[model samples]
Target: MCSFKKVSPITSTGSLLCTSWKQITSTEVPAVSVIANNSSCFQRLYAVLEALSGVEPGEDVLRLAHKVQALPNVSFKGIQCYNGWNQHIRKVTDRQAAIDLVVEKTRKALQILKDNAVECNYITGGGTGSYVFMDVDYSNNLDESGALVTDFSQSLYVLSTVQSVVPGNRAILNTGLKGISLDSGVPKIFGHRDLTFSNGGDEHGIVRPSGNLKVGDQVWLIPGHCDPTVNMHNWIVGVGDQVWLIPGHCDPTVNMHNWIVGVRGGIVECLWPITGRGPGV
Candidate 1:
C-alpha cells in the first residue's frame, strides 16, 4: 500500500535540483544515545561514515577506531527513518511550508551533535521516497551544491479480501453482509476483493450481498481502507503477523531496507509477484 503510492517514473535525466523548499519547521525531540557497536560491525566503518557524512574515508578501520578512541569528535545519528519518529503537521499544503518545516527539523537534528560538541555526518537512507521529503530536498538556505545538510524523522501498510461490484446508485461492497462494517466506503478495484473481516476467519470470505454479486465470476477486492482490526494480537492461530508484512510501510523509512520475516519452521511458501511488477506470472 505504502510502496505503490511512492513509485515515481524518474523521467528526468537531469539533476532534481528542486528550487522550492518547505516552510514548515518541526519541534525537536530529545536525542538518544546511539552507541557504536564495534569496528567489525562496521567493517568498513569509515566507508559508511563517508557515505553519510560526505567525508573521505581517510582512515582504515584501525585508524578510524583509534581516532574515535582517542578523541571522539562525532556522534552517530542512526541515519534510518524507523529509528526516528514521524513529523506531524496539520498537513503539508504549500511548498514553503513543507520546506521550512523540513529545514527546521534538520537543524534541530544537527543540534544533537552540536550539543555534544562534536562534528557530525548524516548517513541518510535514500530511496524513491526521499526525493520528496528528505531535508536535503527541502532546505532553501543550503547550496544546491553542499558539503552537509540534515533532516528530521519521517513517517509512513494493509489487508484482505472482499468482493464489491461498482457503479451502483450508492457505492457499496458485497462484504456488506459478510460481517463487514462500512467504516469507510466500499472498495474501488474491478476484479479482486480487498475486504476486511472481523478476523481472518477463513481463507475464502463468502460475499454477503444485496443480490448484487455475479455468478461464476469474481471481483478483485483492493483495500478501500485500513482499520486497525488487528495489531495487538500475537498471531492469527497459525498466521499472525505474517499477514501484515505483505502490504508494507506508508512512508519509506531510511533505517529499514529489507524485512526479515521470522517464520517459525513452517510450511513451504511461494511469494507471488504483485501484478505488473515483474515478468513472472
Candidate 2:
C-alpha cells in the first residue's frame, strides 16, 4: 500500500525508467475497481482469479498481470489453469504425449512470470477429469513404484433401474440429461465392462449391453463429468448410507446449490447453507 511519485523521465522505448522515486504515502489501503458490473466489491472480496485456458501465448498471458498492475486501484491476484481440462480429450495416441503437452504449457506460463519479475505466490486450478496430473497432494494413495500417487476423478454413482430391455444388446434406463452431464462424454456402466451409454433424452439414458439386462434391474452409471450433473439436482440422496462424490468442475456446481446436506448411518447429520449461489451481480 505504499504510494510513490514519479521522479524520472520515461525512456524512448515507452517503458518506465524510474531510477529514483519519492514515497508519497505510507498508509495501506485495499485495492478496488470503480467500474460497475465487475468484481470490484472489496468489502466481501479478497482477490480476483482469472482463467488461463492455455490458448494464448505465454508472453501475452504475462501482459494480463502487467495491465492490471498498471491500473489506478486494482491488483491482479492470480490465475487459474484450465489446460488440463480442455486438452483431456485431445486426439493424442500416446497418453504420455497428452501429459507432456499440459506440462509444457504450464511451464511456459510460469516462465513468463519469472521473466517479467511478477511474483505469483497464489494459484488455483483443476477439475475432476484433469486434477490427477496437476495435484500434488497424494496423501496415502500410490501407484506402482509411486510413479502415480493420487486420483482426483469424481466417483459419484448414478444408479438407474432399467425400464425396457430390447434385442441387439440394447436397453433403456431412467437416467438422462436431466439427472447427469454428457458434455465431457457419456457415462460408464458399472459392473458391466462391455456396456456403453448415450443420452436418450431428458428423462432416459440409452444403454448398449454386452450381456442381458432385465426389467427392474438396477444399473449403475459413472458420469463422465460430475459438476453439472449435481447442479441439476436439489438434493443428492444416498442409498445404503454411503456416497463417494466429487464434482468435475466445482465452481459452477457450487454456485447452483443453496444447501449441502450430510448424512451418516442413514440419519441426517448436518446441513450447510451456500451464501454465494448465483452468477455475480
Candidate 3:
C-alpha cells in the first residue's frame, strides 16, 4: 500500500537481480521510481538495466529510457538536487549561489528526461541542519538581514550534577564525553552565560563556576550537537520542578530509546514504545 526507496548493493546480475525485482512485485508495495540527479546516477540506471536484461545498455539515452519504461512496475522519478553547503552557509550570497547551482543541475536533468520521453514527476532534495534546539552548527547560518537567524527557540538541555569543586574556580560535573557530544563544540551552561563548560574526561565535565556552584548542585547545559547528545541518554525528563532535558534532534533521538514518557502537570500521562529502534526493524 505504500511506496519507498531501498538502497542496497547489487552484487550479481543473475539471481540477485531477479530476486530484488520479484521481492518488490510480490508484496503489496507500490512501484518504485528511479532517481537520477547527477551523471553518476544516470550511468548507474543504465548499469541496472544491463544487469537485469543481460543486454548492454549503450550511451543511447532514449534506448535506456525505453528499457526502463518496459519494466513491469517501475517508473522513472525525477532528479534530486541537494546543496549541503547551503544548509549551513553563513553568507547569504554564497548560499544563494549554491541554491542556483542546484536549480541549474535539476533543470538539466529534467530536460534530459523530457527529451528522451521519460516520465519524471518528482523533483525532491533539500534539507536543513536547523531543528528544534538549533545546535551550534546551524547557528552560523545568516538571514537576509546579515544577522543570525533567531526564529526558533532552543528547548534542549543536558542536566548535569556537580561532582566536585576544585580550586581556580573550576567545578566538575557528572556529564562528560559519554553523556554529551562535543563534535560541533563544547556545551554551554544554561542560565549562566558567564560560566564555561569544557571536556574534562570520559565521565566528567569541567566548568568555570560563577562562585555559586557547589557539589550536588545541578546545572543545565546546552549541547553543542543535539543528535548524538540525545542518543547518549535513555530518557528525557519533561517539564517539572525537576530538571528536564529536551532532545535537539527528534528522529534519531527517538530511535535510540525504547519508550517515550509523556508527562502532563508533573504526572506521567502516557508511555509509547518505539518498536523501530534501529535498522532492520
Better of 2 and 3 by lDDT: 3
lDDT of each: 0.28, 0.45, 0.51
Off by over 4 Å in 1: 1-102, 111-117, 123-188, 191-199, 206-281
lDDT, candidate 2, residue 186? 63
Off by over 4 Å in 2: 1-55, 86-96, 102-116, 123-155, 164-171, 194-196, 211-281
**Could you report the Cα RMSD, in angstroms, for every candidate shown?**
19.5, 12.9, 11.0
- Per-residue error for 25 in candidate 1, Å, reads 33
Question: TM-scores, in order shown?
Answer: 0.27, 0.47, 0.56
Give a tens-digit lDDT track for model 1, residues 17-114: 12111111221110111112222223323222321212212222223223343423233332322212222222233433654554555556555545
| Model 3 alpha-carbon miss at residue 126, Å | 2.2
Model 3, position 68, has a per-residue lDDT of 50
Residue 22's lDDT in candidate 3: 52
- Shift of residue 202 alpha carbon in model 2, Å: 1.3
* Error of model 2, residue 81, in angstroms: 3.7
